[model samples]
Target: MKEILRSYKQTPASSIAARCIPITAKGVVRGRLRPITGDTLQNPAEIKLIAEWREASADWFTTRFPLSEAGTSRWLEQVWRADDRILFFVEDEECTPVGQVGILHYDPLKKQCEFDNLLRGRKGKFGNIMIYALITLGIWTIEELDVMEGFIRVVADNYRAIRMYESLGAEEIERTSLIRLEENGVTRWVPGQPGSSPPPERELATMRIKREVFLKLHQSNLPT
Candidate 1:
């Protein structure tokens, strides 16, 4: 029974160092974005929610790309171990884990960090709760950590995600081209060329949310 209970423990990502504190926007709203920590989540239901998130994530990514279950699990494990990556589980009014998000701080030379979300089983307006949490966290990180800029790379086909970033005042920086090749006898032609039957390059749209805009938004939402 002890071993089974240990297996059910909700382990926090190793990136965040401090204990998570419940934060509210003046009106004392429960289950907003909180600092990520080992003890942040105490409920077994939340752990189950996170497990569901992991399964859903594996399914989603595998359906989109050629990844094995082991590969996906390993990838998530590495992401959880990174020190510069801050991960948080977004909660609803009832404090239920609805989604997860994180900030990956890049090198100073890069002058940018990327924010992403794995929102699973979201309901109603709470669906966009991860976006709000991310934007708030970005502002806090910028002011407190003195980061220069923040950016996110979203797939061109993810229209909802693109729109959410845009709503947060993030602007498109560039569209990355991804080319995949098969080892078969035939050579694949480059994208944007006619009659070559080449594998089309995926457009990865990068958007930037500046520090000033982030601060302004956060301040506006704060209680006067």
Candidate 2:
């Protein structure tokens, strides 16, 4: 398992994007998860779609700023080359992207990783594509990457996301006050920084679930 993790970490982003991991539900392929590659940024339409989604879902994220296609292109370039992270696009069966998810903050020694950047851009014919996307990603981490646990941090007020995580067997494990940071006209909420005066009332909830627990809860919900 460690070797498998090492291999994935060493794989180039271009190759990763070409590899499609299917997201299935009820014995049907609902969507696919593919890593964002440099080629993805080359497509103007793709960049626009991602920027639009981020702008519309700004409030659901810690960082709130105006998103532009150029900015989105820069972010994609950075994330695709990251050593310990892979940002994925959730594409419907027809290969049209409907959302995005990511595996990041991996700790090989702990065999854990974080699920981040989960945002549903548009509804799919399956209706619950986002839920299946999350479940499928979780299963992949455990079965293929040997991740023992998966976790996510959500804005405390984001009740919809929290409920979805709970339904998939995650439980709130901790809460930390969020400190607002303003720089260059961009506002973001982050964990307390050193020398910070005081924590703000805004908070983020950390939710976690064991690999086996999550698998047991949803793996059987879909057919092999």
Candidate 3:
């Protein structure tokens, strides 16, 4: 098992240009997001354990595909070097990595990006970390990068995740239709609307938390 610690450092404002800003919420007790690096994948046991937790709880996540050790390592490298995205490992009070989260598939032209991967500890600590992270990121994007909006896509049935986002002021913009061709050559659409074939097991719901609302949430939560 991995040990948890709180020696991790906070992300600098300048560093957000190329790295994720590590942050700690009120009840986290300890831990914060850390920059993804080669060393992050050195411990395969911890990585695999987190992946299993995510897979077993697919309903709470958007993408169901699990990353292999190699895939995971490569992903860290891309996010670390990519200016369009930021990645971080959610570390515990003991410095042990629990789960991960990131902003990917960034489109600067649209001033919009997709947020995903808000995995928490096996015991479910740090569940609200993403809320703080998103709020901070949204403020940075708007004030620094001129981004107007941030978007997140969750599994339609992932009530927990949806509730979290809505609590932070995210609003559902549209329900997307995802078509998947099964092994039996059957096409499926999500939600399985009446008169329509049942969609794939995974359905996606897109939600947006505007820059203004995000800032409001951030300010409201700050110490008086």
lDDT of each candidate versus the true structure: 0.56, 0.82, 0.59
Candidate 3 ranges with C-alpha deviation above 4 Å: 1-30, 41-43, 60-67, 74-83, 124-130, 137-144, 183-202, 221-224
Error of 2 at 123 (Å): 1.0
Best by TM-score: 2
Report how far residue 100 has shifted in candidate 1, in Å.
0.6
Pick by lDDT: 2 or 3, better one: 2
Count of residue pairs whose backbone atoms collide, per candidate: 0, 0, 7
Off by over 4 Å in 2: 1-18, 192-199, 221-224
**Candidate 2 local lDDT, 64-121, one digit each (tens):** 8878899999988777666667777898988889999988877777999999999999
Rank the models by TM-score, top first: 2, 3, 1
Worst 10 residues of 3 by lDDT: 1-10
- The TM-scores, one per candidate, come to 0.66, 0.87, 0.68
Q: Enumerate residue pairs that collide in model 3.
A: 4-94, 4-95, 5-93, 5-94, 5-95, 6-93, 189-199
Error of 1 at 188 (Å): 16
Candidate 1 C-alpha error for residue 109, in Å: 6.4
Most lDDT-accurate candidate:
2
